[model samples]
Target: MNRLSLVAVAAAVFALPALPAAAQSNEITIGISISTTGPAAALGVPERNALDFVPKEIAGVPLKVIVLDDGGDPTNATTNARRFVTESKADVILGSSTTPPTIAVSNVASEAGIPHLALAPFPLTPERAKWSVVLPQPVPIMGKVIYEHMKAHNVKTVGYIGYSDSYGDLWFNDFKKQAEPMALTLVDEERFARPDTSVAGQVLKLVAANPDAVLVGASGTAAALPQTSLRDRGYKGLIYQTHGAASMDFIRIAGPAAEGVIMASGPVMNPEGQADSALTKKPGLALDTAYEAKYGPNTRSQFAGHSYDAFEVLKRVIPVALKTAKPGTPEFREAIRQAFMSEHEIAATQGVYNWTEKDRSGLDDRSRILLTVKNGKYVPAM
Candidate 1:
């Protein structure tokens, strides 16, 4: 995650006392790991920045937040999670900005039995599900919107180019699942690493297939690769992007290539486009106003909205957890996990969250929106 902050947040950084047992008991600690550098920085920085605006206290207890840079590396994410458990005694864990690192963080939180609020959407195992909740819409939920949009636009065949990691695998696998039901065929598929500057080989292959549309299952500025290259290579078919590339940075980086590209994204990016009386509109707009106040207008990010929603999650769970257990204890962590499992319809900046024991990601299609880049901005598509 990336950040520039208010004084309260700076002071919170300085507030991590030496772990004196009594001091720890009187305070609640949240450990966050985000990629402030490396390939995913464009997504992580805004996530980091959103933290500055969080409440200074939770459940009437002083809150201490500690952040570590995972550098988009799962190993570093693991290290950060272990430190949260063994050192800071974090009551909960927040994130590592992208999927691979989020998987690492979730596993560590699962093993340690700490509640983890994952900023990215990652596949969860049964064990991980008990301890973690994801902030973003799950692949299937967002993929359905993309598939439906494709159906509406009369797309018959699709090509895929995505990150070679779990993120790519999840999207491609989900697309295969949805496309078949929607009568859309996957004409071809290709993959590239997150750090790769060139996807020429993959773009060339996808361009050759000449499907009705090509889906880029990638995120952040790195996603611009397939976007720019596909255009440069003279592929004129429609381009569809996963929610990961919904950030404005992707539009800027991809420039003219970004225009008319369809995106599967969270409703946070365009709250005004949401129907009136929508539960998500008020909070989504609130986050936009607060975030843009510091970051500047038209700079709001979906990733940052995920980060801001963490406090919204806490506002509900912390009070319930506090009634059962005191802060800084194993019981308290377990209680936080239970609170996540039991919390009812929570309307945050992103969407309405209604989680349960078996399904840690509770968002429905209401969390998703379709957008297209136009005139250097994202606007509702369809």
Candidate 2:
């Protein structure tokens, strides 16, 4: 009787499927699809660094990061998004620096019910606002910021130069919209492609239009062309650049030509500037310092700050979702979405990210800090 009973019990135990591991033991997988190469890599690299650092500070359950290079290509962004959702089984996704890839991946992620942390500058219109949220200031608001600065400087008519892409188009259109309300006129509108060495012809058009100021909108090193082209064409009007163009790379590329160019930017008033800024709060400072220490001085550019915030949002949300639900559970994915939308106060060196449903853009207009080039260096505007 004892042998028979023991044999029967062992058989039953072996036949039963093992209970699924508890949330604590289960590892959280977060997908990071970013431009580790291509033009935006300057900012993307810093973003990757922030993602690498998050788990180290937050001590709890195990975390796994599955990184995919978007190659700064929109099609690749969509492909990587699919892989993250289906192959990597990522609970949440974070990244993409411009509108095209961010928008592309957003469609895939939203369709799959996976929440996305959009790091790009483009604002989430009502149409695309359902599933994704951006960590940086929105694209539309930059135009208003630039206008206010332009107005303050007694500038009325402005020239515009932007990349011939969705990212630039959005910013350009928004700038135009904001300019109209302020009684500012767009004297000329110009476009260029990525990796283009010069915009001399475009600059000539802007010059002939007789604008009181010039506005440059684009990501990466392309921002330099406006400054160089403007100078080469012998235009003397003040140059106003979008915040996204406020990069150290732009300064390096334009050199002396960049001088006197004013760019709308988030506050860089020491660490205090981050208090109200979405992308510049506590972790932002930590990231900037760490990057500088590792990559030498000037490692943390303006774009780097926004990218870091994107990674931070991912780090904070994934673990919380994983702890509450299993990997494949819908609740896990929904939690990540709520984490970004409902987040009231995110601490970063850039500023506090008060993300909300109505405003997916984390940055507030109050945090807009104006920066200008002086002596081949970025300095606070007077």
Overall lDDT per candidate, in order of appearance: 0.86, 0.68
Cα lDDT of model 1 by residue, 1-382, tens digit? 2222222111112122233343238888889989888999998899888886778887668787888888899888887887787777888898879999999999888877788999998988898888889999899998988888889989999999999999999999998787877899999999999999999999889988999999999999999999999999999989999988888899889999998999988888999888888888988898888888988988889898898899898999999999998998887888888888678888887888889887788888788889998898898897
Please report how far candidate 2 places residue 320 from its true position, in Å. 4.7
* Candidate 2 lowest-lDDT run of ten: 1-10
Q: Which sections of candidate 1 miss by over 4 Å? A: 1-24
Q: State the weakest 10-residue window (summed lDDT) of model 1.
A: 7-16
- Candidate 2 is scored at a TM of 0.86
Task: Give the per-residue lDDT digits (tens) of candidate 2, residues 264-316.
Answer: 77653234344443455556567767767876776566656665665566556
The TM-score leader among the candidates is: 1
Candidate with maximal lDDT? 1
